[model samples]
Target: MKKFIMKKKKILIVLMLALLLASGCSTNDTKNNINKLEAENRLLQEKIKNLEKELNSYKKESKEKITIYYIKSTQNDFVLIPEVITIEPEPNMLKAALEKLIQDKRNPFPKDTRVIDVTVKDFIAYPNFSREITKLSVGSRGEELAVASIANTLIKFPGVEKVQILVEGQTVETLAGHVDTSKPLGRNETLISIE
Candidate 1:
């Protein structure tokens, strides 16, 4: 009977040891998981802070506005177009218009060309061209459409009279294939069709 009691005691002790070992292992695993989650959370917070800083920088840069000067032809003489009477183009609008002009496929000029300058005087509109554009073979309708598009867009401003185009700061030979390159452009009035 004493031997039997001793064997039973040994079995109970073994079972207790096994349970304790299992619980210890589980506790270690839980601690590791918690540590991993903390690291991930910290990394995510850092990323968010960096993104916020970048956004703030962009806003600050855009707030530094750019100004352009224009000259208007008056009945008596030429005058500096008043700064109070100016147009502020949305950044994406001109880019979208250029993209549309290029994607039309029907346009004869190279799609890569850019509008260097756009000026409005006495309700007339003018757009200066890049050297790359002057090298391209543009048609009359294409030039007219380009001028009309810019003029009509600018006229939406308070005191714009018209649009004229120049290439590399100088009057170009012509726009696309039509319209005299030498003359300032008159508002087409029809370009208001662009929504």
Candidate 2:
């Protein structure tokens, strides 16, 4: 009876050792699985970041087409010519048109002229310019054409019916002592040459 009891104890110890070894192997497998999952999660996060950057870059490179006016001198006189150009979109399209106009080399505005701001109310667009606008080096006809260039360009927009040119945010009497700019001007189709 004593020998039998000792043998039973030895068998119990061996069973416990086998269970412990099997559990240790299971724990190692679980750890390896967790590490692999963590690595895959990091890789997916990096791919998402890369996709977002690519989308932003594509948005920045996109451009739209708009028609801006430039002065074209004919045999006897000059007229505003419509020129379609590509520019980045702006929240205020009126301001964008004026800025594009100023950027053109053939535009009537004096060199160094800049657009301060543009506001629209009651179908009228008020474009305020820097003091450089007053320095136009043209005669009365040229001044008329310059004023028409602005008025005509803005009038092309759907909601704009007239334009009131301003110098430094105040209503100006005239641009270059020719055309009266104190009041809002309408689109002058006469100044535009379709050709």
Candidate 3:
């Protein structure tokens, strides 16, 4: 009986040691898992910070400066002059430039005229205007000034070598029956004056 009791006591001690070892391993695994989660959280926070900085920079670039041409009457003749204006950035910057010209008070274009759209292809800019562009009441000189102003303004943009004025999406021969707008027009440097 004494020997049997001693054997039972030895088995109990061995079982208790196995239980302690298992609990210790589980505690170590829990600590390792917590450390891994902390590392992953830190990486995610860094990515969020980087994305916010990029968004802020994009917001700053949202405004653009564009040059618009307007007619300025010289002592004896009319000429086109460039005026730099700030506007909201647009995917179609050529259209934005034309709209600014139409809005300028110094422009001889019809008051009711509107810029329908502008499309570019192969270094040519096509500025489509509303029908009111045909209602140019200003005479021959006014016609020249208007066409030159439009052409010079668009040509200054990159990749725009010439301008083809359109009225309601149709190619027109003239804006006021004076300027030949049947073909694409290049920049008229002669009509532009700095003074």
Cα-based TM-score, every candidate = 0.41, 0.75, 0.70
Clash count, candidate 1: 21
Highest TM-score model number: 2
TM-score of 2: 0.75
lDDT of each: 0.56, 0.89, 0.91
- Collision count for each candidate, in order: 21, 0, 0
Model 3 scores a C-alpha lDDT of 0.91
lDDT of each residue in 128-165, candidate 2, tens digit only = 99999999998998898888888988988889999999
Which has the higher lDDT value, candidate number 1 or candidate number 2? 2
lDDT of 3 by residue, 26-130 (tens): 999999999999999999999999999998888788888888889988788888888888888888899999988988889977788999999999999999999
For model 1, the stretches where C-alpha displacement exceeds 4 angstroms are 1-108, 119-126, 135-139, 157-159, 191-195
Model 3 RMSD vs true structure: 5.1
Which one wins by TM-score: 1 or 2? 2
Worst 10 residues of 1 by lDDT: 79-88
| TM-score for candidate 3, residues paired by index | 0.70
